[model samples]
Target chain A: MKKIIFGIAFIIFFSFLIVSAINMRTFGEPTYSEMDDYFIENAQSETGANNVVTSVVFDYRGFDTLGEATVLFTAVVGVVALFRGVKK
Target chain B: MIGNLPYVAVVIFVGLGIYTLMFKKNLIKIAIGVVLIENGVNLFLITLGYRKGAIAPIYTYAPSGQAMVLPTPQALTLTSIVIGIATTALILSVAMMIYKHYGTLDTDEVRRLKG
Candidate 1:
């Protein structure tokens, strides 16, 4: 039975592999990176952070981080609510 | 491409996750599958941000001529990882609750809500 699942997964992934191998961008060289170039060059000057990634996370796209925090908070709230009667 | 071995790893991870999801009977196993998929996607994002012979996005004494990897995807993946942890924890706790309420961890056994 496990073999069946494995076989199906193998075929699906193999198809995906073929599609990606044919249509994929060149390895290690990302196109459509004009935004990346701008951030790399200006992030230091704008955010005073040596790490561009950090600056982008905490500064440039702060609202997205806030949303993620909200999502985590909601999940924690739900989990706590569901398991509140565990000790009782 | 040979240089993109990380993608192969991503493919394996995703495939394993899907296989587990389809075949596993345990709720915890399903949660594990979800985590595996999340990790595979995160790896794919990091891979996309990667560039050959490039340094990380941090600069201290590094010269200007050196190529720097893309930071946006890395940042997005960071949040995703945190979110994944939260979601996994929630799923496991919910599964535990279902087990407590139903007196069994098996999904088919927990079908009735009156239990």
Candidate 2:
């Protein structure tokens, strides 16, 4: 009974997802890209970085990257702690 | 239909992930499901930032008149990939601990042995 209910719900959810994906805007054309335009235009001048994507990741959004690094460090610590004393 | 292929691929990825999460009983399989969902999300972000006839977003001798794909989504996807690696590592480690304690990876058996 539980499995049947779950199956029905899953099917319904996936149908919705498929419908939306098929209806999405054209693949190569994004609707609103002003922010990206600005970044591409001025990232090299402002950050002196040849790669705009690199500048955006490391300089423009430095704090977000820092937070991501912290999360990765924490996960590493957690995994190490969990495995402690298991090799013996 | 051809143009919307990437989005459909993303949906397929996420749908398979969800199915694995809901139907699989093994902890390792569930961890794989989580990773699948993460990859699907990263792909979606990348697909959202495309521009027709665009080249890489680099300023060092780039083509004279070509556009560049969005940089923000690429940056966010890099962060997400790092985060996904962290999450997958943690999940596998926890699954290992559970196997060590309960001597089984089956969710039903693990639940029954809870004490």
TM-scores across all candidates? 0.87, 0.94
lDDT assessment of candidate 2: 0.93
Q: Write the per-residue lDDT of candidate 1 for residues A1-88, one digit (tens) a residue.
A: 8678777867887679646744667668997899999999999999999989989999998988998998899998998888676685
State how far residue B26 of model 2 sits from its true place (Å): 1.0
TM-score on B-chain, cand. 1: 0.89
Worst 10 residues of 1 chain A by lDDT: A18-27
Lowest-scoring 10 consecutive residues by lDDT in candidate 2 chain A? A79-88
Instruction: Give per-residue CA lDDT, model 2, range B28-105, as digits (tens).
Output: 999999999999999999998888889989877878788899899999999999999999999998988888889999
Q: Residue A26 in model 1: shift from native, Å?
A: 2.3
Where does model 2 exceed 4 Å of error? Answer: A86-88, B112-115
Clash pairs, candidate 1, are none
The fraction of correct interface contacts reproduced by each prediction comes to 0.63, 0.93
